[model samples]
Target: MEATRLEPRTLVNGDMVAIVSPASWPEESVPAWIARQVESWGLHAVIAPHTLDRRGYLAGSDADRAADLNQAIRDPEIRAVIASVGGCGSFRLVPDVDVDALRADPKMLVGYSDITALHQVWNAAGVPTLHGAIAGAHGDHVRRLLMEDADTVVEADRGALSAELTTSGSVEGRLFGGNLEMLARSVGVVDFDVAGGILLLEINRAAGLGMVDRALTQLRYSGALDGVVGVALGSIDQFAGYEDRGWTIVDTLRDHFDALGVPVLGGLPLGHIEDLVTVPLGTAAVLDVDHGRLTVDSPSGD
Candidate 1:
């Protein structure tokens, strides 16, 4: 049986949202800025205690970070939990998250990049999540996704690196995926599966096509991409022009994706670019590759 589609209640004026640093610690100013932004939407913002704590690359000790997240999850007043940033180390806190509580009182988890680890676990718990930045040029759109009742349609970026790689076909499936490296590392670690979903792939600050090659190869050989109906490529920042041994990032992507034989729609303005468009995971979506469009059902609660 298909898992029932579960959504958190949509945000409303006076609702509380938690800002936590479950991954790497964010800059000190980020919590204040994010709080102001959330308040501007008429929603209250609660900054978790360890949002600014830094223990090297991690936000804090795994125990502290998990405590902050668990506190927010168990709080009946908080309706949404958003990450301050995704520098690194969210994966370690996954096993410690209060998944049972979150499943009982469903709330959206929002962030991307390293936060993809949290997204994986939260999504596996049968809750929809937003793959987006907490604060950026795209914050307004992110607000709409959390607070509004409308479908989101993302058109392909004609000039993006993956734009020319689109294959012809259309598919419908639940959206599933995030940062390519995180997805690769998740194999055998996180129980989240990509089978029967439209896989999303994006990259930022990667070390050329070899890293991309190895990640994709790992997922492919591990049988993670087995029943994926289609793929949507987001920004591959700084790698559009990168060439290694005369092979570009696009060359490496095509070699692996071509083997999957699913319709691929590339260059959608999603992921870690300056003008990012937030997207939801674990929600139903229509991938129309021929028309260069992705129509996704709003994950906002009714």
Candidate 2:
């Protein structure tokens, strides 16, 4: 396995977290709601200067958004950095990020969807991130990881996870994946280490069945899934939209993933779900398909 990441020191009740927007703009009330939510965890929330700034669809200009994120990453008082929401502009901000400072002062970064680009950047810098929202049921999981410990274990099954097994077996490897589309977009551009890892995927939009199939097919063609040990599928919000004249998303999933000959388990309450669960990206994990479990092996240290 590749060298595991060195997670930052866990936050405490008195620590502070910075909320910024590197992607599209969130609702006017979102940042405030997130601030309140973080405060409830006993941690103060520092809303970045440009967090709510608007420039068309993005929270702000690419430079400004990147600045907000870079500032949060460089701030010593910030115990954690979370995105306010996900949109299209994050990928554009990646180039301007202060990668050097981020590496020197690594802190937890959490978000999903377009934030997947940011997560990939952090993971590459040896900082694992939580894949979930900053608010709601899944946010609780993110809070626990930040305030408590990284040496933790997470499980899924019929009770906590309403998943179905397309192929059944067991396997263990580092966890890698987020928004399927974002991940696929990074196939050539980002050095995503999917090799020998359990790929976790979820859908945020009901784009189309063809697009979904094409994305997965692209991943396969790019050899991004090469040596991948298993696949843990997460929530597909509005999944019914893909059903057309008997052709469902499930059929599409089985078509693409089953051929990989790896354990494929779907129905995880993760990403774009009614209840999102925080999933650590670029961490060693295990997937037991037969038992319907995906356990994150939160290590003690690097």
TM values, all candidates: 0.96, 0.92
TM-score of 2: 0.92
Q: Scored by CA lDDT, what does every candidate get?
A: 0.86, 0.78
Scanning candidate 1 in windows of ten residues, the lowest lDDT window is: 1-10
List RMSD in Å for every model shown.
1.4, 2.3
Clashes by residue pair, model 2: 138-276
Per residue, candidate 2 scores C-alpha lDDT tens digits across 76-111 of 998788899987887887667787887787787888
How displaced is residue 160 in candidate 1, in Å? 1.3
The alpha-carbon deviation from the true structure for residue 76 of candidate 2, after best TM-score superposition, in angstroms, is 1.9
